[model samples]
Target: MSEKQETPEQRRERLRQEEGRGNPAGDMNDAANRASNGSLVDLTGSLGWKGTGILALFMVLAFIIYAVFFR
Candidate 1:
């Protein structure tokens, strides 16, 4: 008996069609959630006490410099 075999592209298309039957939006959301598992800004890790202090110090110093020089 002569049977026709699916080509690689046809197999791939069939698999893709099968995958499309699932929740694509849910899959995308799952991927996004995995990608952003933690905080977006990460202030706790990237800007700890020292970084916060430095930022506060810069703001205060800038205000003082502007008041003394320009105001």
Candidate 2:
């Protein structure tokens, strides 16, 4: 018998497979939750369209300031 160490990605995939076996819709919800709450710019949770619009406005203002003042 041989043993192999499972990487984090492999572990997640295995767990997802196990989770899917029980409830199909649950797997989709789990994926949506993870995607919404993941570390890189969570868009769906607290950062709704209003926050996104504000952020975009700030970005555009910064760009205008940079072009007018710095360059």
Candidate 3:
């Protein structure tokens, strides 16, 4: 039987090396740049009109159904 042996420091070093090679910070920076450059649209203001209309429609329909069936 062969046993794999790895010390805690060796495991930590391996993880650190892997993370450095993966360059997650660079990916985050790219994402931030894209977001700041308007590649992503700001939806908070538009949602007030569209989402509110949909929600109000849903509430009206729910009230109509409840009145017809439950009361």
Candidate 4:
């Protein structure tokens, strides 16, 4: 009797099944849950509008200086 060979799709399915058996929760956890309790901090609130504005102004000034003088 001749043995049946698996197709590419069948081989891929087998590999997926084996991976699922090895790590059942592999898909459950991801980069979205890297932060504990799913709480991504609000930098805007912590930094405040004034602080953020100052930072933005400084960044703009630096960019302008770089473009004007360096380039």
- Backbone collision count in every prediction? 0, 0, 0, 0
Better of 1 and 3 by lDDT: 1
Could you estimate the TM-score for every candidate? 0.38, 0.41, 0.35, 0.40
| Candidate 1: pairs in clash | none
lDDT of 3 by residue, 1-71 (tens): 12248654456556655776789887577667868785312332345567757867988999999999998
Query: Per-residue lDDT of 25-66 in model 2, one digit per residue for the tens?
Result: 987887788777764344422566688788889989999999
Where's the lowest-lDDT run of ten residues in candidate 1? 38-47
- Candidate 4 deviant stretches above 4 angstroms: 1-41
Question: Of the pair 3 and 4, which is ahead by TM-score?
Answer: 4
lDDT tens digits by residue: candidate 1, 31-66: 577477954234434576788788789989999999
- Can you give the lDDT of residue 25 in candidate 3? 89
Q: Which candidate achieves the best TM-score against the true structure?
A: 2
**Model 2, total clashes:** 0
Backbone clash pairs for candidate 3 read none
Q: Model 4 over residues 1-71: C-alpha lDDT tens digits?
A: 12258654456557656776767687346323644554222344356578778878998999999999999
Candidate 1's TM-score: 0.38
What are the clashing pairs of model 4? none
